[model samples]
Target chain A: MLKVTNDQVAGHKAGDGKLGPLIDDLGRFYKPLQSNERGSNELTFYTSFSTNTRIPGPIRRFFPNFYGTQLVEASDGSSLQPHLVLQDFNFGRVNPSIIDIKIGSRTWDPQASEEYIQKGLKKDRETSSLPLGFRLSGFQIYQNRELGFWKPERTFQSLSADEVDLLLRKFVSSNTSANLDLQPDCSFASIVYGGSTGILSQLLELKAWFEDQTIYHFYACSVLMTYEKEFVSNGKIPCAEIKLIDFAHVYEGQGVIDHNFLGGLCSLIKFISEILITPEECTTEASPKDIQKNQIYFEELIK
Target chain B: MLKVTNDQVAGHKAGDGKLGPLIDDLGRFYKPLQSNERGSNELTFYTSFSTNTRIPGPIRRFFPNFYGTQLVEASDGSSLQPHLVLQDFNFGRVNPSIIDIKIGSRTWDPQASEEYIQKGLKKDRETSSLPLGFRLSGFQIYQNRELGFWKPERTFQSLSADEVDLLLRKFVSSNTSANLDLQPDCSFASIVYGGSTGILSQLLELKAWFEDQTIYHFYACSVLMTYEKEFVSNGKIPCAEIKLIDFAHVYEGQGVIDHNFLGGLCSLIKFISEILITPEECTTEASPKDIQKNQIYFEELIK
Candidate 1:
């Protein structure tokens, strides 16, 4: 039986009578094709991207391995519908910690309708995407073998600049609980994001491709970062994977650099790199006032 | 299309016009049921073991998670056949190294016919099983991102006692290639087999259960050991898994200890533990003559 993937930290989900992605026992993810132009566009993107010889072999590893498509029994009990068959990144993981960061300050494509552009612009401005070039759409952290998820109701659209950093800090903190507290322990930061094979290296690899290639412009796309919390907690070297997900709003770049995506990626990389350099003891001992002072200092530094 | 599982280290395979195990894209293992009593016996064992309240929950994790049965198109182009749908332990693994070790010095049960017992005894005596309590049925090791498998022709039936130890050590050595060389690097042994969450601890947990439970005697059963060579070589803690596989020859223990399986398990554990304790430098510097002398020392210690 197909099950709704609990580890999906963001994007559309299987609920409210809408067909969402379903994961099967064989580590295959079946994402139901939406009966709209968006679905067709995504299918087209995956198909073209798969066979595109211009895309280097090294860059291909950043995207999910698409196994074409299949017609499966729909989750909503509808007729057999075509679904994108992709690799389930969270498969065979134990207590995996995941974060979905929606990239780009502008989420709408150039060809988007005026109404769609306005809607996307409003969300981008309301979240950290405007100020920081990226926003935390959702995240789930496993602490002490228990999962603590970011509340859906929060939407994370109104987080202040400091709050955004706090969230990113909490994501790498081993002592942080589910309440999204700003904890002092950044012990897992270097292991998860700093090493040669860590998320930083993978994102930089993707950035290098985006810096030169003008193949596709990805709008409303997210960088999904995942690592096993069980391994991290046990003091094992964390093997982090970063994948670019969501392609409903992807469009041809027309030989232009995707500055929007590049900007957001650079911003996210800066935040992670800063976290790797920050002193754990300083964060551990900081009081609320000290944190406020530090925030003011950070804001001044950015200015 | 269903594919023959390439990662399966041993047992009846799909070749030779016979139905073998098939792995689906969803990471489910479909082991075809035999048309004889052996198939029915295995089915009964899984069905009963799944719901057997007498078995503790901890012990159940050692066996594959049974997802009932499925009727799929046969690999031999025959009609629909029932296959036991179990969790594919090797799913979602990158360059997984696997070994299938058939447990027990005596592989034939009391219920076997006289002719069958004699045949089993002859084979066991000829192999390492009679001398070392267990024998390597088959194995595949991943090195340098390439898979090197043990030759099927070799069968691994005639390995001497010291040769068995060398094989165990090679299994954990990162430098050992597919040619089954006696490498000195046991770098992955402590992480894969010695730690609290490693194979040794997991085996001890299973041994604890076998010491008390009077469930069934597993004749010709195998303990399948697997870990990701990619993770191990990358200096990540190897999350090794050990599963009790192949229940075709299982029989009711009738309120007695499963000493046959237990003894083999203990012997296997001892070999692994020895590998963990042996200094890496000692193995690295040892000559062929030194290894021969060490083999004699090990033989004397075992006696």
Candidate 2:
């Protein structure tokens, strides 16, 4: 069952409930594609919006349906409770190695924030800043970096302390260029690995979504990840078993630039770097020369 | 410009003009796709029913744009018109070597039956029969085998005598197993080459379309081809210059057999074989054993 959203989780209603707007936008965008003879069938309901066929064979089973809405009375006694209907989507063929995890703006637990992410922006304002007009409330973390088991109705589960430590150790050891030794403390590793990786997966999924389909996603939260489960050995977690999900707020167009999403992603990258090791050892440095070249290219294109 | 259907061309009006039925059917088929969120943007006005995008990249450039329609003065003196409008489509992009040929039930020319095709069932009953309730009037041909030029508004053109002869010679010579030699006469070559290749391309495209997109074309008659100009060596037409067009009547379903289209195609194939060589030398022979195996498989599945 999907986690229901209300004022308690975030200030806004679960944006997934905004499915109506999504449907309308898609209809409008696809309005011009009516044809009597020959063309693509990609725009139809099953192929376009639903994960039924669009999700590739390897990762499709995790997101089985766009299960419709549910109304639940908050534990805080906020609203009326009738029926909390859960939607199940038969996205595609099942892959046994799938452990779906959805994290984002909506998944942010207000009670647990002080320990997960510090308040305010980072020193480098741009990297830490959200994109203009984007709401942090809508941010989602999608990670498919680790393999997991195939279990439907799996909501976001926090990584165990040992799992986080094992993952961070794997990350540091894998990067030969970063000359950082594995930290001995599991407590610190959990904060860095569990928090940063969750956010990192969302960023990677966002970049990949654009590259694969040329579509940009605005509401990048509500992630679903899939992973293989058999790779677990000796308490060490493998780094390559995760996959992300959800593409409801994605759009297609020409020359449509995404500023906010990218800004948020970069911020996450920086945040992860800071938490994992000394700031000086971070490999995601944007060299002055690279920045200058991009500026020049942008100027030329504009001219 | 699109070839407008009217009383003069066939007993019924032009098929394209019957957009109402087409629209209705497509709407019904695609109505389930009316999702509020994720779906295809490919169904806008032109992309859904046209082969413009579905055609392989090798042949896409030849047919660009939904060229507007033309109004022709009815031979029956039905409409008072000073000018007949012809529709020209500017499909997206262009590649140089396209020689488009639309062939199928709709492409059957009224007066030119003798040189082209004679209406009769083939000796092989299976190839000429209709699939249960399917209508012959709805037959359409699809061809995108050859590469074509990207000039917009380029309609179908017949292959020249020299081009036809050259291509036939190539076909016969290329197949090492076929022990036939190229005939010296251009007229005989044209008859064999023109008639045989036209039907051959349709068959090739039908098989290819199913393999590529999983959509089967039932009325595979409207043919379009695109070929490179440089391939024409000294007036001798190259066998590689031909392609078929049209995919308007194709469908997406299971075991939806296309008997009439396949029958006509097989008949044309047989006709070509006869023209090219003695009936005994035809290489397209099907062993009874293969047919029996298919029959058994079908029976088992049905049972």
Candidate 3:
């Protein structure tokens, strides 16, 4: 029931600059499927599909901090579109603490500095020509709900001398291969909130550990769909509302929860590794390492 | 699921001796319903169905401990029944150091003693040869998969003096009337186990606290359900495999999650005052003149 949109929150902005393709140079990467002009205009195409489409594996993984992934049954079977849903998670819902971390702690936000912006722009040129966009409909700030939304980059909040050295040593590619199978003492179905007690979605999985007795088991599907849109405008806003119209097909579908879960969880691991851990201990600058030095930590606690 | 039967338990004698009626009486009190007995030669008839079908209003003054009262819900809807289940709450499940209280700590078990037996018989004779019946069932001692069927009543463990006094004090009398409620931190739900976990047919009215939210609001029912049954059978050596043949259309159907909640939470006031409180505390025992002298000096604490 929580509405997820830029309008419902504080601070808003739109892109006026052009973004060129950046991913083609990544070589051996994936290609996009061709699309045809929709029966309706682009704005309708974008809105109708984005909300309905199931989150993609890559995208879902990226937002590891999402509270509950409601697998709402999309009303349309033929429409290859994401399920239109209101999310409980909102990035703008942060502390705005303005506290500083030391250098080399998190991923560099493109909007953070001119150098990073240029680097990001160059990188985007390799990925795609169209501008990647996100907008907030609305958001409310709260207490315990604000955790896990902020993305840190190149900044260490407070690290001792040994901590910093140890972190760099860890990221030295010395521990590249390690077991990432350690399951967290977390429930599959969880309620993720913003900084405070903001109610997010409810997460439910097929065979999650919940009740005393283990009951029925069933197969499920994870699907994602995309839509094109026209210039977005909010009445008098600088741009026209980029309304999504079509929900044609899944970006990708028909996979197991484990695979999707792994991808999502792994992405979170990447985030933690990059933002929370030291660079020497991480493989990707975007996330924390997929492994841990101690597996017994969580197993014993759960037991 | 775990099960309990009078046959394997240590203390109870089955279908024989003078205690046969007593055991039968206990069983009837545990769970009572009429049998069709189509093939039997003898027919049983109600002696005072018209008069005793409804619990007298006066008993309501006692609350929680008066055993439950009934009012038939049929056209002759005078036979309405209430919910009040009991089970051996496995404290060891929380920790081995937790103490167990004797059945007679505050109020002596009327059924567990010889004097109660003699008095019950005399009262039954005076009251149409039938004691007022109750809809009770046992849920705690049953042996389930990992532990098998077991009993927890074997260890007739005595409560430490301090514990006894503390628990007694906890059943504080209300200002306006002689009623009771559990202390804030004392989530009494742990005590609602039967031979199996399902016997919580009594707590229908208090199901709201169990359905949702995550503070673990009242008590931890799942932990109570997961303890090792071995300790139970080792303790309640002479326990009985007791059950209710039919709930007789009772139960608000509060599912397994809500079962362990103490249904008659409000009724404890009477259970404490009438059954547990010393006769001297009531106006019945102390004379109007020297009642203060007759009362025992209240002790704050003892090392």
Question: lDDT per residue, candidate 3, B1-303, as tens digits?
Answer: 112324222222223221211112232221222333310101111212113334334322111121332322222223433312222322113211111111100111111245643453343223211111111111123223544332333322222222222332322211111121112121122222222331132221122232221111121111111223234435522211111111111122111111112211212222222223242233212253332322221121110
Measured with C-alpha atoms, the lDDT of residue A85 in candidate 2 is: 25
Off by over 4 Å in 2: A1-57, A64-69, A81-234, A239-282, A285-303, B1-227, B230-303
Per residue, candidate 1 scores C-alpha lDDT tens digits across A1-303 of 788888877777785566789998889899988779999999999999999999999888888889998998877777789999998888888677888999876687645787786687668656766555678888877677454543343466555545666666766777766442445477788888888999888988987776566678888899998887668777786768898898988888653446567656766775676677773634323487857665554354324
What DockQ would you assign to candidate 1? Answer: 0.01
The model with the greatest lDDT is 1
* Whole-model lDDT, model 1: 0.74
Model 3 chain A weakest lDDT span, ten residues long:
A225-234
Assess chain B of each prediction and give its TM-score.
0.89, 0.33, 0.22
Candidate 1, clashing residue pairs? A25-B26, A26-B26, A26-B27, A27-B26
Q: In candidate 2, residue A137 scores what lDDT?
A: 21
Q: What's the CA RMSD of model 2 in angstroms? A: 23.2
Worst 10 residues of 1 chain B by lDDT: B145-154
Stretch of 10 with least lDDT, candidate 2 chain A = A21-30
